[model samples]
Target: MAFIGIDLGGTNVKGILIDQSGEMLRQHYLPTQEDADGAWRDNVRDMVKYLQNYWQKPLTAIGLSAPGLPNAQNSCITFMPGRLPGLEGFEWSTYLGLPTYVLNDAHAALMAEATFGQAQHCQHALLLTLGTGVGGGILIRSELYQGLGQMAGHLGHISVQAHDDERSVAGMPGSLEYAIGNYSVARRSHGRFSSTWELVEAYRRGDPLASYVWLSSVKALAVAIASLSNALSPERVILAGGITLADDALFEPLRAFLDVYEWRPGGIQTEVVQAQFGDMAGAIGAAGFARKQHVG
Candidate 1:
């Protein structure tokens, strides 16, 4: 059976056609325009229609990974930001005319990793995606934990530093995102580089500013992960998204910091690894969730 997965983001919408084994049979991508009111939902419907037109067999279900709180019935977005205007309170399942399973993008990414990526065998894990901002989700015993209001896993919002600096968002002093996110690295490094890859390369070349910025980011990430480890005792912490692509420069320092700070009972170790599926994890997880809903 084939499933259609849609990953809706601020700047683009990606779709994938996958079978039961998670193989991508087809894929599509298009720009996401913030200017068009209600255009996001229309784009999704069009994308689903386009995918269905190409497949020879009937699709089992459609899964949507969106960047907001899904409605109570898991049908649509209830609280999207300005980037996705007209998404809030939109009932996507009815609009698409299909059995749909909608999930927060971060949560869907966690599901993808737990089922098919680095965290596949782990019983407890935390997935963090460090992009324009930081997003996070938690899986315990291989089940997604959607807390009350479906907003329990905002790890980036956790205060890690107690500075009186005005850079913090919404009065949350020193958020993890402020320290470890891509923009944070750029701001701290004072380099013209815009992406984490450039910063990583600079660090590799032994650039002093890049080294300082990278170390600070890794330290903040380690502190956050350690606190999470102490609280949840996850078997593994998976780092996803573009920022973590800094490769060994980021992971090595993060691992060393965790080793020093994290406390484990009986000296048990928690493995920290990058996500295997990279950007496609959300789509895969959405497909998986859609399969489950169809089966039930």
Candidate 2:
């Protein structure tokens, strides 16, 4: 049997066809066309239909990975303001003509790891996707933990600076996202850099301002991670997304800060690592999620 996973994003829609063994059989991508009226849905439907027709085997199930919070039943995104028009309250099963499981993209990323990637064997793990903005997912007892309103993994919205006036998109003041996310780089650095990569480059050149700003962001991230570790006590933390591309520059300072901030009892500390998958994680994870739903 085969499964189809669709990852719907602001810029693109990615779909994958996979077999029972979790190996990707076919993959495709299409532009999201945000300005078009309900055209993106047609594109997604076409993509899914193409994948289904391309594979000769029986199609077992379908899954979707998308932005915003899913409703209690996971049937649709209950609230997704400001983007992906017509996505909110849009039921995939009704549109796709198949029983479809829908989940937040971040949760789907963790599901991918849990189903086949680094967290496959982990009873407890955390995944943080640090891109334009920070997002994350949680795993407890090897199961994805999507709390009330499926809002459990909005880790970046957690505040690291309580007194700061800056507010994140989630209405969080001085959130971890604002401190470290590429979206706020210009505001955080007083216009010195437009992107996190540029800031990291300047820091590499021993630019004092760049060093101060970048290190501050890393410090905030460490504090947030340590705080989360205390709360969740996961076996490991997997970091993904573009910001992590900073490599040693980001991890080195982050490690030092974690050493100071983390409470390692009996010398046991939560391991922090990089994610194995990249841009395709959501689509792959959606397929994995669908397989689980189908088998159960």
Candidate 3:
């Protein structure tokens, strides 16, 4: 049977067709568009239709991984900040004409990593997606944990700075996202750099201002991660995002600061690592989730 997974983001919509064994057979992508009257729904319908057509047969099911909290009962979207307004407030299955399971992209990312990526076989793991905003997911005993309101893993919104003006997209002050997410980094840059890469490059060149801004963000992440380690005791922490590609620049400082800030009675043993699936995790996880829902 072929299942299709749709990963909806603020900028791009990615869909993939996979078989029972989870091999991607065909893929589709489109930039997200918005309309006050919701024409984007039709565009999405067409995208799914095209994916099905590419498969040359009816899809077994469709699954969606999208931004924000899934409403209780998981029937529709709730607070999907940073997503297009047109996709909000609707049951996706209604528009797509398929059996669809909607989950938070962060949750879906964790599902993918735990099942088929870096955190495979781990009993406890935490995944943080560092993108336009920070996204988080928790895995316990190999199972995804969705707390009440499906908001258990908004790790980016955790308050890290006590005296800062930066607020997360979630409208909370001094949030981890505001400190580390790309938007937050850009905001802190004060237009000195047009892109995150430029700021990172400035840091690479040993520029003091860039160093201060970038390392401060890294410090915030370390503090937040340490704080969480105290509470959850995850075996490993998986950092996934466009920003995580900063490689040594991010991990080196993060490791140093993480060790400095993380406090444990015996010693914090969690290892921080990057995700394996990169950009495709959300779609793959969404597909896996749909397949599980279909089977179970």
Tens digit of per-residue lDDT, candidate 2, span 200-268: 999999999999999999999999999999999999899999999999999999999999999999999
What does the lDDT come to for candidate 3? 0.82
User: What's each prediction's TM-score?
Assistant: 0.91, 0.97, 0.89
How do the residues 148-213 of candidate 3 rate in per-residue lDDT, one tens digit apiece? 989888999999986777666677889998887777555688778755677788999999989999
Worst 10 residues of 3 by lDDT: 34-43
Q: In terms of TM-score, which candidate is stronger, 1 or 2? A: 2
Ranking by lDDT: 2, 3, 1
Q: What ranges in model 1 sit over 4 Å off?
A: 164-170, 190-195
Best candidate, lDDT-wise? 2
Model 3 CA lDDT for position 102: 84
Off by over 4 Å in 3: 81-86, 264-268
**What is the per-residue lDDT of model 1 for residues 1-296, given as tens digits with 9 covering 90 to 100?**
88998888777778888887767788887766657877767788878888898887888889899888886677877876765767777776678887888899998898778767787788899999987778889998777888877886778888788673635544577888888777665576675567777878888999888788778878988999999988998998888888876778888888899888988778798888888877777777787678656553
> Candidate 2: what lDDT?
0.92
